[model samples]
Every structure is written in C-alpha cells, then in structure tokens.
Target: MSGQRKNPQARDRTIGAQLKALRQEQTTLNLEAAARAIGWSTATLSRIENGKRHITSEDVAMVLTTYGVPMAQREELIESARTGVQAGWWSRPLPGVLPDVGTLASYEASARAITDWSFSFIPGLLQTERYAAGLMSEDGAEPLEVTMRWRARLQRQRVLPTIDYTAFLHESALQQPFGGVDALREQLSHLVQASTRGLGVRIVRGRVPHRLLLHPWLLLDFPDAPPVLNVELNGSSVFLHDDEVRSYDNMRSMLDGMALSSAESRSMIGQLRERL
Candidate 1:
C-alpha cells in the first residue's frame, strides 16, 4: 500500500479518517479546540475533517503533535499525507470552473459507476460541445469560460470507458433547444450513438407528476470508498456522503423503475428529433 495509489475519493477518505481519528482519540480535543491549539481556524479544520482540502505531511505532523498522538500513529498519518492526495487535473490554474465543479470532476474520475438523474438540461458528461457552451453561456458565464468548461466536460466524457454510466434524462430535457434546434438534434443523435457503446442512456419518458427531489443529482460510487451524491445547485454544489446519500439511492431505484430501456430510449430520442 506504500507505493500503490488509490483513487482520489478513496485517498481523501482515508486521509480524512486518519486525521479525524487522531483528533478524536488523542484526548477529547474537539474540532474547535484542536484548531486553536494548531493555530488554524475551525473552518479549515472542518475542511480537513471532511476531506475537502488536501493536507501536507508537515500539516499532518503539526496537528498530530498538538493532539499528543503517539509516535507510531503520527508516522502512519504522515505517510498517508505524503501520498494520499491525488492531483486534480481540472483544478489546474482554475479558469472556467467553479471550485465545487472541480471536486465533481475528481470524483467522476475515480467512480466505478455513475447513476445520474437530471430533471433539467442534459447531464454534463453526456453533453455535446455546442450544447454545453449554449447552456453555460445562457447561465451568463463568459465566452472563453464557456469554452474552458466545455472542453473540461469533454475530457470528463473521455473517462466514460472506465466506469458504468447510467444517465436518466427526463423527457423534457430532450425538448430543450439548448443550442437551437440544430445543436439539440446533434446532441440527441450523439446520445443515440453513445447508448450503443456501453453508455446506458435511458429515458424517463414523461413529466414527473410528483417531485420529491426537484433538482438534478448523481450518485458516484467509488470502487473502494462508499457512494456519494453530487447535487448541483444554482451557483454551487454539495456532496452528500454516507447515509445522506441513501435518498438519492432510493430516487435512483424509483427512476430506474420508471425508465425506458436503452433501445427504447434511443428510439424515443429519434422520435423526438423527427418532430424537430
């Protein structure tokens, strides 16, 4: 395990666990107490505990010593801090992406399966370049920023081969003229093709009469770490971990139950395109 690299999600989870355990067990040092003793803020420590920020070996050493952890535990955590954080490619230089979106990219890179439910426009991973640009621009992101985000989204699509992806696109999403009629047609045609190539592009064929989770979200299942839910908001996103993710799981089962088969989904897309 020394040289073996874990997925970003698994690595972060392991590192966060080690740090959290050290803080909890070495006396009753709660988050605020430990943060003050280590000369950091509670928010910063909370990020560390939640695995939202990457910590260095020195950071690990300093926190452990402040908590009076044993030498052996300190060394183990320091070693983990050294190799546990995998680099995030989308995070480089930070031009077109929101901070939380970069976090989404990292999770997608390491997921074993992605079960998505979209009530609005198309899911990012399945979107074409023009469709993505249109949506981003319509949302008021700058032109160059739209290109950067679109390219990054295409890069994410390239990772589709490595995971099992099931996107449950509501029927209304197919009706969106995202980049005008031409772009929407092209995008739907692309989806039809993608379905044949290991992508489970299913259609939930009608308006959802009742809404429980009104927005779009996805469940990213890591090969090692437990599943997490990725929910996109108006300007930000949040990850629902552990038991909080179960609601999305239930939602997924419900959607799948309501979904059309892959073949039928492709047929539905074709039928919609003909009316355009």
Candidate 2:
C-alpha cells in the first residue's frame, strides 16, 4: 500500500512549475542556456521544470543564482524547496483503500473550493460516520480498516467550514435508503445542518436523458493553480487537468443551470426527512 501511495510530490510539482515560470519571465535565456549555466544536463533541468523529479535546496540556489533571481523574490522559492521535502498527513496507510486516496487528500489540502457531483450516492465529505461505516461494510473491509478509513474521511470533513464546498446531488440519491431508513434519515438531517454552516447541498431535479448527464466528477479549484477534475472509474481515479478540464466546465455549467435553488434544496431535504 505504501509503495502505491503518492509521496509529497504535489508540492514539488507546484514549486517546479513556479520555477519554470520564473525562469521564463525573469530571464531571457531558454532551458538550454540555463542548464549550461547551472552545470546540469538539459534533461535534468527539463525533469525539474516538468516536476518529474525533485530538486534540492542547493539546486534551487544554483538556479536562482544562474537566473539572477532578485533577493526579494527568492524567499518563497527557498521555502517551497525546504517544505516540499516534508511528508503530509495524506501519507497515512490504509489496509484496503487505494493509495490514490492519499492523492485526493493532497489535492483537498490545497484546494480553495470543491464542487462534487454525485449521481448514485452521497459525497464522502458530507457523510455521517454511521452512514460511511454502513456504506463501507459491504466492501468486505476489516473492522479496523473501516475505522481507519472513516477516521481519515471525518478528518477531511473538517475542511468544509474553511473552504467553499458545493455539492450537486442527484434527487434520486438523496431519496435512497442507504444504511437503511433510519440511517438515511440521519444522513439527510446531517446534510441540512451542514448547509447551515458552509456546505452547499443542491439537488439536481430534472430527469435528463441518460445520454445527457456525464459521469460523476469532483472538481477541485485552487487559488494559485489550475482546476482539477477527478472521475472515478471502477474504484480507481482519473485526474483531468489543464485544457482537459474545459469539457467538465461545460458539464458543470449545464448542471448549474438546472440545479435547484439552495432554499428550495434545503426545503426539499427537510421534506424528505419529515417523510422519514
């Protein structure tokens, strides 16, 4: 599991991207000239620029010196290099869950906002412990594994109050009796409470044709970086970035136009809870 888990590479990638941008904007020299000046092979510099490999503080110092980076603009890069080597909480191990779970956690840590589209089940961020345990038990995960997974998920939920979270849930999903009727009622009530705090739980009401709705996706937006769209496939994940996220943007816009108003959504959820 540890072998499959993503390391603290996201920060390295972010730093590398910043370095590449700085080198391009601050210096007239291209990669070849910069590599020669820094006494590194062109391929090594390319890997560092593309975030395919990590760079040490000395390497950063060398690049900064070669680029003649102003002292004022050098602190952030030095700090990024120093901190990128540290491991994050996402590195915690889980028995049966995919190592990519760590990858999602890293993204969540940096995201300024998250928009989740759930077609068949409740989004994990908004799930109650009982609800989560109920859902996970069916996977044949061991008791300890279930506890660990739920604990990690609950910890991740702490970010909801600090960040913008808008959940687009299918009406059918909100009505399903997951974890039985009683647990489902609890989950609905929890959603109501969460919305009052910061979570936006909007119900997607229209019965669009099967061909119209795309696969479920989670879009994470960062204040400094590009948005990422994560789509789960057969229990694994696909992370779409850069130009690829535009199509997802289109789908999000279509859904946004059709989703119920927040007030109406809250009322709808209240009514569902009352029926239970």
Highest-scoring model, lDDT: 1
- How does each model score on lDDT? 0.79, 0.77
Please give the RMSD to the true structure for each candidate, in Å.
Answer: 5.0, 3.9
Candidate 1, residue 162: lDDT: 88
Q: In candidate 2, how many Å is residue 166 off? A: 0.2
Mind giving the per-residue lDDT tens digits that candidate 1 earns over 129-148? 88888888888889889887
lDDT of 2 by residue, 1-276 (tens): 012213334565577788899889999989998888888888978867765555676678778888999986787788777776555666565666666676777778778999988887788889988878877777566788888888778767877877888998888878767678888999999999987775788998868647335577889888776787778665577777678889777777877888997888989999999999
Error of 2 at 189 (Å): 0.7
The TM-score that candidate 1 achieves is: 0.80
Off by over 4 Å in 1: 1-10, 20-47, 63-80, 84-86
Cα deviation of 245, candidate 1, in Å: 1.9
Q: Model 1 residue 134 lDDT? A: 84
Leading candidate by TM-score: 2
